[model samples]
Target: MIRFENVSVTYEGADEQHQPTLREVDLTVPEGELVLLVGPSGVGKSTLLGAVSGLVPHFTGGTLTGRVTVDGRDTRTHPPRELADLVGTVGQDPSAHFVTDTVEDELAYGMESLGLAPGVMRRRVEETLDLLGLAELRDRPIATLSGGQRQRVAIGSVLTPHPKVLVLDEPTSALDPSAAEDVLAVLQRLVHDLGTTVLLAEHRLERVVQYADQVLLLPDGVMGSPAEIMTVSAVHPPVVALGRLAGWDPLPLSVRDARRRAGGLKARLEGRVPAGPDLSARPASGKQDPGPGPGHGKGLDGGDRVGRSDGTGRSGGFNPFRRRRTEAPAPAAAPLALVDALGVRRGRVEALRRIDLTVTPGETIALMGRNGAGKSTLLSTLVGMIAPTSGTVRVAGRTPHTTTPRELIRQVGLVPQEPRDLLYADTVAAECAAADADAGAEPGTCRALVSELLPGVADGIHPRDLSEGQRLALALAVVLTGRPPLLLLDEPTRGLDYAAKARLVAHLRVLAADGHAIVLATHDVELAAELAHRVVIIADGEVVADGPTAEVVVSSPAFSPQVAKILAPQPWLTVEQVEEAL
Candidate 1:
């Protein structure tokens, strides 16, 4: 349904000095086929998707050299509004896609724009609400819903119009595992039963690789079947990675297929125990164990202190000085954060109820649940954004709601669900400088973190110009500058690719070891398995399950990682663990 013939896009700012963003992209997507677009963070994947919807050169103010047509309608001549009846597009930021207040209104807005029959619109709206699991949220205002909930509403709004071609960018980035599966299943039905063409771009290949009939690797513009593309593609799912590790003939796309051929790999790793997050690494002090002070840098890298001092009593963020103490800690260490019978009410909704949780120093916790299940509510409560209707929340022994922003920076820091909320500066350099000043750290602290997390990012680039993943990395680096004793991250890996995610896991591990407490409200199961020492499952505003990562995740099929599912009953959580054992 979508065809790009010798298409190339170059923005106005580029005066032949820089190469075109999309160069010589010639491809044709067959009707009724689901094509998966895969590439690194800054590649032209989003640009390619925009070409089909006519958002690239039309609305984005770029020059288009070639032609892009959808269903016999050329995108160049037909603007987004003219093509809206035939094509539906959902971008990364779902909030930007909304034009109405309530969930039901947002879903019906598209059909109303098309001037569809009122009865037909109502029927399609109801079907979409049920299909995307937005029935309960139909009456809720879009502003009051969580990030993941907004994503579903945005998708349902496009889906209600019943367009022939659907183009999605990171459709499942904000969704939980189960909700992502449901949305992908609905897309599968559209492809198989209804014959709708879908062109999607997502970094989480493990979730969508199996659903794709054809895989399109961008920048290089390589297109082929999933097996053929994965065999040579650098960015791939864990199932394909494991197939490469075990030397399997054909890489498997799904867990079931991988499991059928995993008997031998399981046998090889039968007696070996997987290496888990090191939770015993703690400070060797008998003192009150005051949380990570400005000069306290022993926790991150095996006693490699951060923040060097030039006799000013303020050290830079990273220092090469290493100091390790072998002595053990005193008994009865205090918890970094304490939540007792926490109850939060937003309007008429009980966002959280009777929740009890604790985080000691040097521990990582993963909060897992479905969409609108109050995971973000719990994070907001802990960070002091929302006051509790009942119970108490204490971080670093101070009530978050009662603490001042200046004082709270030393005690706790939060990288909110929307990463843009934490950034306001014009340039990347300015953002880092502002973070250093706000956190009272030496210069270059935030810049160093950004370089480590997202390498090759220019200092002059504007935060708004960054890709979703690049922007997220910059936000994370800004938060880490403070060296807060208690850190909270909401969906930390939303737009990150596998390579970027590996960098994040490495950095978080160092922080956890350096005596900092971390809490992640997330839906990435593989991330939880890789970095979290404890997994807490929340459902209906209550903690249904909480235990060590392996025991909690492996028991639940929905939350299990691909390696755990492939090597069944073996307690393996990641391909790295299996590879380490062999």
Candidate 2:
């Protein structure tokens, strides 16, 4: 249903230069198959997706050689609108695709644009709402919906058009585990039942690897069976990594398959126990303990001593599962930040309720909940972007709301859900230079950090032209340049592959060890498993559960990572932990 013949994409660059994003690629996506396109950051995955929907050269102002066809219609001859009936494209940012205010209306907007009959539009809208499990949210305004909900609405909107080919970029990147499964299930039904062609790109492979019919390896643009491609691919999910470590001949794609082959591996790991204190056994005390020291080599200085709740100062450690010592020693320093009785109202909606939170130095906290559970709202409030309707937020002993931008940049830096929002300069180099100048850091500091986070990204490329993962890396570099005492990142792993995520986790650990408090609003349970010292669960704008990572994630079904789920009854959280035990 989709074909790319001898295609090459080149974008305009400095000095009238042209940079090739895709080089001499030939591909064919059979009808009714779910094809997963994956590669390293900035390796032309999104560019390839854009070509299928005719956005590459036409809309993006790039030069496209050869041809791309969807459902036998040449994309070059037909613009996006002309192919709208046959092709529906949902991008990484769902908000950019929205044209209507309400969920029901958003679902109907595409059909309306296609000039469908009102009755047909109504039936399709209802069917889509049921198909994607958006029935309860049909009447809700799109602005009030959570990130995951907005993603569902975006997919449902395009689905209403009944396009033969659906093109999606990171469709489930924002969804919680259950929500991601729901979205993937809907895509599978479209492929199996209706024979619709679904092409998608996602970084969180653990969630979607099992559902793929075939894998399209980019850069080289090689296509093969999922198992075959996964064996050689670097950007694979945790399960694939685990399979590799265990020496499974054919790597298992799904958790079920992994479990079937895990018997022997499990036997090998039978008597092994994860290193660290037993989180459940550790009693809650007034004073918190300072756990393991830093692991990230170089650049980060881990010499700062954190005062324990008991008033004893100790060097930082890098244990991922360390519990936060709640009760500091009587003479200990105050928390780096505090949120007391925080309430925020956005118009008629209560975004955040009376929430109380504390962040001590050197603590890595994961703020997790269903999408729209006040996670982003809380982050915004902490950074002074959103003024709370009531309650007080203090970071570095100063009110975040009343602090100046210059001071706030040094005290607390926030990376919002859309990383592009933080990028403003023309090129990556310019952005990095600007970040250094703004943060009063030495020249090349931001660029060096970007190289550490996302290597191989050209300095001259426009920030807008970089892949989602690369943009996030640049944004993160920009934020870290200030060396803020507190860091707030919302859904930071949206487009990062496994390797990128690993780098981020390591850097975060180093940051935590260096006495910087980190709070992340994310749907990535696996990240929480690997990096968070404390897991804070929010629901309906209230803190439902707050405890050490193990206590919180292992107790909840929706929040547990794959390793935790596989090795249930055991306190393991990652492949590295499993490896360490054996």
Candidate 3:
């Protein structure tokens, strides 16, 4: 269905010619096959996907030295518009793909452009709406939807056209775990039931590796089965990592396969307790002694509050507000942020409601829930992007919604869902320089952070030219330059590989050790396992679950990490934890 012959691409540079992003790539993707393209950030995965849709040379203004054909049509001669009927491409940013105001119209726009019959278009639109669970949101304007909702609309729009080939770059990056599973299930149906060809590039291997028919490891452009490639690939999922740590032959791609082989390893770790990080300390609360098991001490239940008392004469029902001065045993340090009975409304929808959360110094909290379940809204509320409809939100003791930007920068910094939103400079060097000046930091401080997060990134390269992961790193560096007391990140690991994510985890740990509070809204369960001390789950704009990371995540099947799933009934949340216990 797709073929690449001696393909090499290079982009013209201003002062000096740039290196080839893709070199000597030769491959063939058969019909009805799902080919997962895996590689580290900036390793030409997106560039290769663009080439298949005829966006590299014709639209992106790059040089192509080799022949590329899709469905027996040469991509060199056929532009994106010409191949629209045969191929549908969804880029990293789903908002960029929007051409209409409402979800239903966006889904129908592609079919209308193809001049499908009215009856056919209507039927396809309804099917797509049902398939993607956009039925209730069909008439809603796309602008009001959350990032993950926009992603579903973007995908549903393409699927309505019934294209033979789908070229998706990080299709599930913005989706929550359940929504990701739904999207992947839709793709699986398309491939098996309709014989559709899918070429997808994703950084989160754990979500898609099991669904892939073949793995195409990039830069080298080597293609093989998932088991064949994961054995040597630098980028991999937690289940594969666990398989490797346990010395299991032929690494497993899915949790079920790994679970079948994890029996012996589980027995080895039966009584041994994992020496995970001790993050039981809460704001205004004294240090909590380590418990007998993982995450057992000082963990808050869903209904438990810091000082609120139940009839049993015990603190219960979590009240994420300031305690009265009359309370005994005063807090050691004030909370970095406090949200009390928070409510936010966007249009007719209630984005958040009666939500209560607190960020303590040195705490790393992970905000998790289904897509469009108010995770982003809660983050925006914390960062002061959205004003609360009711109740109060304070960051560093100052009201975030009313605080000045200049003053807010020092107390709290937010890296939004779209990393590009925080970036405006042309070149990477200029961005870093501006961040340093904005934060009043020493020279090269931001650049040094960028180098640590994203090594080997050239100073002269335009921020637009960097990969999604690279842009995120640059944005994170810009935010970290200020060294704010509280940090807010939304989907921080969207496009990052395992190695890059590890670096990010290490950096955040260092920041937490320095007494900086960190909160990230994410769908990456593995990230929560590796980094979060506490997990807060939002559902339908309310706080449904809140507790220590292990206690909260392991109880929910959808939110559990692969390692935890493989070694069930055990408190181990990561392969590293199991290894440490062993």
Candidate 4:
């Protein structure tokens, strides 16, 4: 059992700018219980774990005036590694934890550090590899893994130690929906089967809610904030959003739970719910095409030009699916370029072999693979961030290297791995306004558009003071203002809860319908199946397959199925898609 007896942490000011991260926080957790610690980034969620890990004052050089005892051992008296046998940790940035180049070695590294015997280490490593579904990658070099794969390795490294308790700080924060799910699923199983007490700090709640035995609603425990940091927001995911406008309960935790709770309300409304669009109409693969093959009177591949009022859109020569139905007509025709024919590199590391990728407007693209597969690197090249060491790179009829960051901003918006990097403004409103104005919006219109695209942003707080979920929405608000034809998001749903993630997917579905070409780099197969119009797989920096999203995900059995993928080989990004396909 873990107990925080009036836990209060105060850090010495580095300068006048130095601020406190956590305040007095009293909390407790029972043994063998799974607790989820969540709040906006920079909150005391991480500090809470550090208190138990004995890394607070000991490592951070902070003034700690609290008693954090785990298993009756005072954390203040013990060091983190000294308590390593009792607690395991998986951090948000996994790249920092690699102990060796091989997956097998990485697992062995932890046990070896603890001075475990060779036979015990071998057996533990083998069991953990299979449990985490890393058996195939066991022999693979850690240098060869993708971002998601490396994260898995980080988890395996700590878990193989067989600690009594496991603490994961934003373990899935950087993973795509499915990759996040994979990692969470493994953690859930550990708590359920092995009785490893689990404490995780997470921003994304949708996937973890169903599995959580208990939830801790942490306030922004900073020494100074709008509310003294002790006010706890609701920890559970809400079942509905705008439903409040219609006077609904609005707090359903899961789909089944929501449906069960909504039955009585549905009868009271008696069709006032507006006979919501039949989700069953979704296609088995790809979105519903009115035509026989590929829909909408478009040619093969959905390539056509379209124009925008801002002098940015291409006309009939672009992908029509990405153009607004009622907006300005497209510009004169021009040949749209694909990103294939390039080899990408990351410093001394070769991230991608030559990968040829094609992008068409109105199509949602999903990129998948093990960590080190180059999905992130490939996305950067497409968005014009990283240049290809070889081969030409083309995005929106131009090579990424040729496009300036500002120019790329208009055409390509990358939802980065860490949302904090996207935020620099003092306040959430200011950040959104800055994003809109930077994207070439007229004065005053940016704020209105930000409100329209993102819900619950105007709570009156600084962007830095908001939660990770709030910050993620603020970043999205800025990106949506430009309404670019091509949108690239690394992983849009990383730090969000289930309800939040579902809302984000709903928004993306709308974007896809409006003819916005989106390329999402993630480890989430479910999200890919749901929102991706097509799925692209990258292995060792080379694209292996690029086609319909469901088709690509179906090929990998080690890769679990999303809801739609399970029912059909093709992925279903939304529930309605499955219903429609059925």
Q: What is the C-alpha RMSD of each candidate to the true structure, in Å?
A: 8.6, 6.8, 7.0, 10.4
lDDT per model vs. reference: 0.80, 0.79, 0.82, 0.59
- lDDT tens string, model 1, 1-582? 888899998864333355687899989999999999998886778888888998877887778888999999998899998899988999988978999999999999999999999999999999998999888778877887878888988889999998999999999999988789989999999999999999999999999999999999878888999999999898998999999999998889999899999989988998887764444466432422321111111211111111110000000122212221222354366888889999877777777778888788877789987777788778777767778899999988889888876677677777877778777888899999988887778888888888877786778777876778888888888888877888888898988889888888888887877888889988999988888877788776777777677877887888888988999788788888887779
Candidate 3 has an lDDT of 0.82
Ranking by lDDT: 3, 1, 2, 4
lDDT of 3 by residue, 241-349 (tens): 8889889998899988998898899899998766767554333344332112233222100000001000000111233322211112434778889899998877678
Minimum summed lDDT over a 10-residue window in model 3 is located at 303-312
Measured by TM-score, the strongest candidate is 3
Q: In model 3, which runs have C-alpha deviations exceeding 4 angstroms? A: 14-17, 278-330
In model 4, the runs with Cα more than 4 Å from the true position are 11-23, 40-43, 175-182, 220-337, 340-374, 384-392, 401-415, 418-485, 497-517, 523-582
Off by over 4 Å in 2: 14-19, 277-331
Best by lDDT: 3
What local lDDT score does residue 357 receive in model 2, on the 0 to 100 scale? 89
Candidate 1 vs candidate 4: the TM-score winner is: 1
Give the per-residue lDDT digits (tens) of candidate 4, residues 462-501: 6654445556666666666677767777666665555455
TM-score of each: 0.91, 0.91, 0.92, 0.64
- Residue-wise C-alpha lDDT for candidate 2, range 115-154, written one tens digit per residue: 8999998899889988887887777877777778888899
Quote model 3's TM-score: 0.92
How far does residue 478 in candidate 4 sit from its true spot (Å)? 9.0
**lDDT of model number 4:** 0.59
